[model samples]
Target: MKIKLLRAATAGLFGIVLATAAHAQKSGGVLRVYHNDNPPSASLHEEVTIATLMPFMALFNNLVIYDQTAKQNTDSTIVPDLAESWSWSPDNTVVTFKLRDGVKWHDGKPFTSADVKCTWDTVTGKRDSGWRKNPRKEWYSNLKDVTVQGDRQVSFHLGRPQPSFLGFLAAGFSAVYPCHVPGRDMRTKPIGTGPFKLASFKSNQSISLVRNPDYWKKGRPYLDAIEWRMVPNRATRVLAFSVGEFDLTFSQDISSRLAADIKAKAPQAICELAQFNIQTQLLVNPIAPFDDPRIKKAMMLAIDRKAFVDILSEGQFRIGGVMEAPPEGVWGIGPEQLADVPGFTGDVSKNREEARTILTELGYGPDKPLKIKVLTRNLPIYREPAVLLIDQLKQINIEGELEAVESSVWYNRLLRKDYNVATNSGGSALDDPDVMFYEAYACGSERNYTNYCDKDMQARFDEQSSTIDPVKRKALVNKIDHDLQAAGVRPSIMHQRGNTCWYPYVHGVSPPQNSHYNNWRFEDVWLDK
Candidate 1:
């Protein structure tokens, strides 16, 4: 099944496409789909935020990409995309990348090292960039310089080495932008060398994509077109799925009752894939009462993580820290360590008793209730976990009031550190420990929306970035996780199974372990005849 795509001979290839159309599968086609959120601003730059960016990213290309498969939860599985191959220096601080030749952006311009250099410099080197205010600035701040060798090759010089550099590339934010455009102007129009080209985008309604005829990969994206419709209601999306209106849909609203109903009827229509993502966590804010070790210990004991997972997560298992490391790779914490965390084993009675003892020893009793407001989003899955947590906190004489807020306001309040506790979910940047640790736990990371900061954790995290040695890097990351957990930085309730469903007819479609959203390489997906 090895096929070479020759750009110089595209007409010859088109001749073959015309010749093979009758016998082979149809060429240059499209697929129709739907989503719930409005199309984010038409920006190929890193500034815009929209689920619609997925389709646009697919049309454009990135420096590197995820190896689309099921086991992407751990690092070391990513394959190359724009950069044909790469190498690390002896100390692991410098990364030399060889760019792929003959790749073209959707606008028909050749992709080269210039675009790569521009992309990196815009996101990391700019004096006052869009991401400057983000907490995760630490992740990019360490990048010392980017060296462009030629049109086809480039290298990154780090002030210190970051082992998880590849994981950073795998994120959708790492998608390559055109060199012709300045950083500020790119926020409005995103262009890449991907499989699909943006056809049209109507905010909050629908977005369409057409097959990229000049795409480097051959025999891909079997569908002629793709349509993404933003349908907000979960019930409506499910109904649309049932009626065959969509080939794929994104949902964090997988309910046990819905799973049961699917099992009972239309069994073949539903499929599920869950990953250890931003499940729900009662992040212990490191201010005031929580800053006291005794209070932190009492709260952990008083709260039952098991009941939340069992009753609300619907039997989803809790994971310690973030990495559910798979065996046989460059990085992993292994299954044994994953199972040994205190509240990770799903032992409700034990955890409850432990909480009670800790709180009792701290001079707190059922009569002296510990009051805390639990901030939660209005989404169904989030609300379920919040309600379950509130009920469980009551068992330990903790009065947890559920303060449900709209999604936008909730995020604002979270940034302001308004609540004592809140429920949040975060997926790994496709199998890389660096994505999770750097983006979520890094002391000043933008995504570290929680105000919790540990100097030791931050220093160690920064050290791991530049440390190229595998053993040393792992040790540093593990230490960061250990110290943060001891500080009750954020209590991760469960390593939830990230789930996705598609119609049975949708063949050759698999979800990535890195992100909860639809993966980018949909070029090979075709409806079964």
Candidate 2:
């Protein structure tokens, strides 16, 4: 059965109301939340990491949102947020949105349709013409123009109809902001038409937000305020939660083992377990002997996915292509097709034996070994997996040391292509394969840390992105998934299955299957205590 929305009154299937079986809503308590990190900027137009994005989730709203309260099958559907309703042209090239009339910015400024037009321009890199580092600007490649039609309507002209344009709108990168404020100004102080107003913010520490007194939707945002605390160390955060210092910790902020601790100690807390699209991956840069295809294939054959699932996820994970297996009925390679790929053959012993043979043939049988460092982020969760990867590489005569760097340094090295073989995490907020391919694997894409540039891969990615028909697109997507695995640049480790917890009284929050930071329904969540 689908998890019903705790409150479903203000909006439809997209709305949140007190579900018949859930507790009645209460309106005036402060919700204390524990998070992993603080954002470099609260504005939507910035390099967004899951760590940095968690603390400021309540301060902004996207034009379109993936409905978290919807059933697993329909969860990715585009729903109203700042945009109340919208329509597309007969040719599908133009999308026109009718903005909600009564919405007001946190400063009491009327939120006109022009803000929508300007926000898109900022995200697409039109607002800051020479600034090239907008990490998510590539999401709007199909946009030809955005024009304000009237006081309440705005229209978007696309270069071509992207079948999954809604997926772009639903991304956290698509958070809408006021047209009046300078984009840089928003980095320190943000103002938006969301459920909360930023009361105080300190980078890398904590953020506090108070209820929007005149929030567009009446009688909503059941909590009066929120205090989001950033607890970077995993063990420290678990201790804080156990001592009743926190009300909730979203998925990325907590690991599986810690969740079990919460369930045991804080037995009254509600722990929700689900698999999100986040994946652990092994990205081996093609340098020195790594450039040899045999070495690449051998590296792919070294690890056991089932073991990683047991080690990291506690057996709650799913292993598949670059994308996760679709429990949401989204198009993805089935189990049999997944087994035929290079690294996911379902038999760890057989794959390891073949891997050792390849390494032995290349004159590395442990006496003279292939040594490299597996660079990973300093987080315990990531380091734990990196150590396992080193152990796996040992079976194939590859001696490795675990190198842990801070988050900033870790990402900079990847952008500079300075690492050899690294264990990393990468995935799309959207279920659509086009979103994943364009963001991560497309040639010269900023997120393309592996330096993978192949014309055949590009062609397959492009064909799928442009195909509007679901059936035709699914065929191309499955083919691309197979080719990505067959080429062996980055091998999917496992789709992370972790738990998020909240006090039983923290009602109305239903996290999305993917995009842990995307669908922030904090406005709908309230405290019954």
Indicate which candidate wins on TM-score: 2
The whole-model C-alpha lDDT of candidate 1 against the native structure comes to 0.61
Q: In candidate 2, which residue ranges exceed 4 Å CA deviation?
A: 1-24, 71-76, 129-132, 252-256
- Tell me the lDDT of model 1 at 409: 61
lDDT of 1 by residue, 134-197 (tens): 3334557668888998898798887665556666666555677777754454444556677777
TM-score of 2: 0.91
**C-alpha lDDT values of all predictions:** 0.61, 0.74
Question: Which lDDT tens digits does candidate 2 get at residues 380-446?
Answer: 6678889998998888888999999877577778889899889986656666676778777888777
When summed lDDT is taken over every stretch of 10 residues in candidate 1, the lowest stretch is: 1-10
Model 1 — TM-score against the truth?
Answer: 0.81
lDDT of 2: 0.74
> Which one is best on lDDT?
2
Candidate 1 residue-wise lDDT at 276: 30
Total clashes for model 2: 8
What are the runs in model 1 whose C-alpha is more than 4 Å off? 1-30, 36-56, 73-76, 108-110, 127-136, 180-188, 251-257, 288-290, 325-370, 462-476, 513-518
Cα distance off (Å), candidate 1, residue 364: 7.1
